[model samples]
Target: RREWSFTLPAIVHAGTLWLMTLLVASELDWQIALGIIGETGLGRGSWNEIAWGLVPAAMLAAVGAWRTWPVTSHAQAYRGLAGSGLAVYLVLWVVLVNLVSSGDPWPLPYLPLLNPLDVAIGLVLLVLARDLLAYRELRPAVPHLWPIAGAVLFLWLNAILARSLHHYAGLPLDLPAMVQSTLAQATFSIAWTVTGLVLMVAASRLRQRLLWMVAAGLLVVVVVKLFLIDLSGRDTLERIVSFVGVGLLLLLAGYLSPMPPAEDKPTGEDAA
Candidate 1:
């Protein structure tokens, strides 16, 4: 029942998985062959430089998106697969960052981290959130609600990812290390928060459900994350950034989606 548009993403995704597994296997020379560390080019040029690998995946995603414009029974699936493929590529980039630590005692630390469970948990939550938001069948009374869920899931994912990376980096377990962790988490929170705010504004202006689901949902999650988790271990500077950055973003969201002054914006749930 699958067509080319439906199947291309699958092929690309499977190819990517096979390629990554093979690439890592050859790089590590695990089991079949021993001793081949540092061949994979880990800790290579600036992380941004390695992004060239993403271009192909990006093009595929664009194709999927374009394909969706034509009427078809499986149009949504095409977009979902395309979007999912794109997200898979992005998440892989994050996972790859920690695989090549300079200090891990293991001879060649390229295996994806799964022992802690947080890494796996974060990955699941983010993927699920994306799938949920992307599903065209989800017709929430308030379309904006979906993005909130997705964004929150991603915030937790980001927090956990950063925290885990810092922990394994083998920094001395002291105040300095704690500060570094907090700083790293805070930096990600701020960046995601700002991005969410921008999307929220865009969603408001366009009055589009898709935009609200991702953008507005982002703000919801970031605010929750700021209070629930990020507040505890962070230092004064980190707190300032969290509060100032998020506070300003909240103001921006408000500006863009300014509330009904007893009448301006729609009152019912459909307004979203």
Candidate 2:
């Protein structure tokens, strides 16, 4: 726990330092600063880039330093740091988005709703951390698999409902010319839907490494399509490709990875 005490303080300190840097940087070139703020509308850039990027990446080098000494379980420390970090980051994001939106020429579209995924993931982590800290006794009987199952079910239900609703409403949900090809549309819709399911499930499980890899690959594909492809304002195909590819990769990885040991039950704390 002592390690977490330190780690949380460090992240807070780093975030504060980064925020200060950005405030100073914003003064240098207001246009560029506004551009940075606007980029989030296209689903990129945030305080994470402005502040955290400036910190030495090695700040995490000593994350597990106390593992050997075992003053407190490494898991405990990690949970503490993660929870605190999430809170700090969320507040910073809201504040920065508000600040930038106030002075910009164009309105920041739904700044409050910016980065739904980040909000969702942070909430999940916060819940997990709380469970790890306060409910150690209840972990054994809790079904850790519920997260994966629930996510899958949620995605499946939502996709089905969306399709049904669109059909019943007789809405013209057709893709643009560039993405309207039979194969392209089908490939994208199916692939993305599957990928979303995979991501939801993975997020529920708290698989950090897998989540990061999936997110990175998807981001790369999405960026290429959005910026590089000249689809004439009709770039739905790119998003479909990103979602489908990332989801497929996540599913493959999940299948190949070893399952948790059957007899090694989760502690009560894990369930919370």
Candidate 3:
């Protein structure tokens, strides 16, 4: 026995199928368009590779995150659709960054942050962060690990960029030995301290207590490293600069974006 007609369910399923097909077709169209433009070779160069990869993913992500779909269902298909875009974008980002940073003909310059790939990645992250903040309800619907994963990616990129700079100076590839030097050690500490401060500012702007705690933990690690390792090294311009820079950043963090307020527990009187 049936309490309802099959008509609505049928229409919904049909609509989902239609949308899925449209998305797949659009992906194919992108590849075909790239072929027509004579940039069909994947892995020939960094810019061309990104054109064939990140550009389409970015477009899909922007569309999914921004557009409103009419169909709604218990499975929350719309949320999944949007999450798929984010997932694909992130996966492609990891692949491209590794490829470009390692041995691409167009390696990241001495200033890796200003390189095209990192700049694009940073802009995409900023836009995604803005969208996520604007649509609060979408937060729980998307993958929960993205925030932590993004932070890890940021840290890893900074290390890779630093390594690139070190290699450019014709230094040996021995990481442990490299860190023993004044400049390398200072670079590492400064990068971590700056990263922590940036995260603190972001946490304050986002009103996220968890993010604030994570930033605090990162700062603690930097402090521990400073005391244990940096203090043992001879005083040099690099070391002095690192210490001064960290001090200024700490002051800025305190002034501009203090720790987020702790959550208040409900008391008996409040409950009443």
Candidate 4:
């Protein structure tokens, strides 16, 4: 068992991040920023300001995690700290901002914009999350959190890039918004399906059921998003094409991502 230590530096790290979040997040106007995304597009929106505050915050957390990963005596504590800090940082941008903006004043439900910098920051956090999971020193609390953080970041990156495509295509505004957005959904689904396959393979290698479960969960999210959000108001033929294409994609994923084999029990145990 590892000893838990209460050190000044550890307290400092936690305290500093918490204080920063509270202070900076207080002044940030979520409604206005999302309005920018809805109007000026993802590339020009107020995300630049949010990114200035949050991207660095996420970077700082990931750096702290990497630095403390190798310390023996403090490894466990640092692992917890790293995962906690990372989850908190990523959630601020990924979930919190989106949830807040989607309702209340702005009432825009589409995803918030992510600048190039935010995507880059998300990449860092995704790598850090994997590293945290790789370390057994991480507490049980970790497996539940860091993987979610990584998934959220992954989705955020895809949504951000997808928004650009939706914009560049310049589809007519007269069409139902959902129907117009199907192109983005189909494109994004391809990536999501591919990512899900990779996750299933990773889960197989690590023999972690949770990883496979999350991968399956992601595929489900894509299916639901396509049907409920993107396919609404579309013509019959377009809907048919999407359903057929996505069905084939699911079949491919199922073929490529075999579940781990069941282990044989000892004879006596099996008999018992």
Worst 10 contiguous positions by lDDT, candidate 3: 1-10
List the pairs of residues colliding in candidate 1.
Answer: 147-213, 147-217, 148-217
Which candidate wins on lDDT? 3
Q: Tell me the spans in candidate 1 whose CA falls farther than 4 Å from its real position.
A: 1-180, 257-272
Segments of candidate 4 deviating more than 4 angstroms: 1-44, 50-87, 97-115, 123-141, 170-180, 204-210, 217-232, 235-241, 263-272
Q: What is the Cα-based lDDT of residue 184 in candidate 3?
A: 67
Q: Which stretches of candidate 2 lie over 4 Å from their true place?
A: 2-188, 196-272
Judge candidate 3 at residue 68 and give its lDDT. 41
TM-score, every prediction: 0.40, 0.24, 0.57, 0.54
Query: Candidate 3 on 1-272: residue-level lDDT in tens?
Result: 00112366544644564466457656655664465333455443345434434444454444444444442332233334444444445555655565344323343344555655555556555555554554556667456856666665775565465546555755544556556766766777788878888989998988888988888888888778777777777857877887887788778878888878887999999999
Clashing pairs in 4: none
What RMSD value applies to candidate 1? 10.8
By the TM-score metric, which is better: model 2 or model 3?
3
> What does candidate 2 score in Cα RMSD to the true structure?
14.7
Model 1: lDDT equals: 0.50
What order do candidates take by lDDT, descending?
3, 4, 1, 2
Sorting all predicted structures by TM-score, with the top scorer first, yields: 3, 4, 1, 2
In model 1, the worst 10-residue window by lDDT is 44-53
lDDT of 1 by residue, 16-120 (tens): 544554465344333222222244644332222222223334343343335333314444344445444545555554454333322222233322244323343
